[model samples]
Target: MDAQAWDERYAASELVWSREPNRLVAAELADLPPGTAVDLGAGEGRNAIWLASHGWSATAVDFSQVALDKGARLAEGLDVTWVCADATTWQPPAPVDLVVVAYLQLPAADRRRAVRNAVTMLRPGGTFLLVAHDSTNLTEGTGGPQDPAVLMTAADVVDDLSGLDVEVVRAERVDRAVTTAEAHRGEDRRTARDCLVRVVRR
Candidate 1:
């Protein structure tokens, strides 16, 4: 979806995503010391706000101004900068200690562009983290984009940054549990497959 479409979606809902950070983002980054960070394609600034609350200066970049506005209202006094810009082409004023791209599904070419551009915002020794619906999620997992073109694999993401000077920390398919109506009634919860990539600029 384009920025206008996303704006409508965000405007139609009170919160498109949760107020808390993504599970994997918090789990992997909680140990790192606070620093300047950027959340690319940040939907509602949840992760960026969380980072700011934890003492990190965070910039939340997204194409949808409506989403950014909602996030800004939610973030009231936090140190989170909301930028209405395309994540695939936007550049930070300076390199930061960490860059996060979560659930930013796009076609292959655009995805590659976003992945590569995100890395460029990281300083040497800085972290770059991305999480999205795995390509296999359409058939093997649950609750994600049904379009295959937008889904990606961990290896695909790593390949997107092939010429960059970075060390892969973790690049793998991971599971995210999703609660279903059946699960609420005591059935097994389904899981969604996600590609998680974490690398550090060398």
Candidate 2:
């Protein structure tokens, strides 16, 4: 979906995504010392807010003004720089200690470009975490983008970041339990199957 489509989706709902950080994000970064971080396509700042609370100076970038506005309001007292820009082209002011790109779907080529862009923003030894709906999730798990172009495998992400001495700390199809509220809302009957990849910049 484009900026306008995402804007409409956010406008139609109180919160399009959960208020908490992605489970994979929390788990992977739990051991790392806090530092500068960038959250690409950060919708409503859930992960960005969580990063701030965890001592990371975060920059949250999203194209939708509505999402950025809501994120700024939600992050009223936190230290997060909210930037409204398209993730495909936005560049960080400098390399950061952590770079997060969670569930930001696009065509295969565009996805690779975005991933490369994000990787370029990571400082040496910094962490780059990518989480997305597994390609098999469309037929096996809960609801997510049905477009095959957007869904990907862990190997796909690894391939995209090829030249970067990336060691896949975690690359697999993991089952994440859904909340009761989500289930009751008919969001998805079963847990989500997500592909997670954590790599360290060389």
Specify the highest-TM-score model's number: 1
Q: 1-202 in candidate 1: lDDT tens per residue? A: 8889999999998999999999999998999999999999999999999999999999999999999999999999999999999999999999999999999999999999999999999999999999999999999999989999999999999999999999999999999998767634775689999999999999
Which digits, one per residue and each the tens of the lDDT, describe model 2 over residues 1-202? Answer: 7889889988998898888898889987888899999999998989999999999899999999889888888888888999999897899878899999999988899899988888889888988998999999898877789888899998999999888766667778888776444645655446888999888888
Tell me the deviation in Å of residue 17 in model 1.
Answer: 0.6
In model 2, which regions exceed 4 Å deviation? 179-189
Residue 84 miss distance in model 1 (angstroms): 0.4
- The stretch of ten residues in a row with the least summed lDDT in candidate 2 is 180-189
lDDT by candidate, in order shown: 0.96, 0.88
Give the least accurate 10-residue stretch of model 1, judged by summed lDDT.
179-188
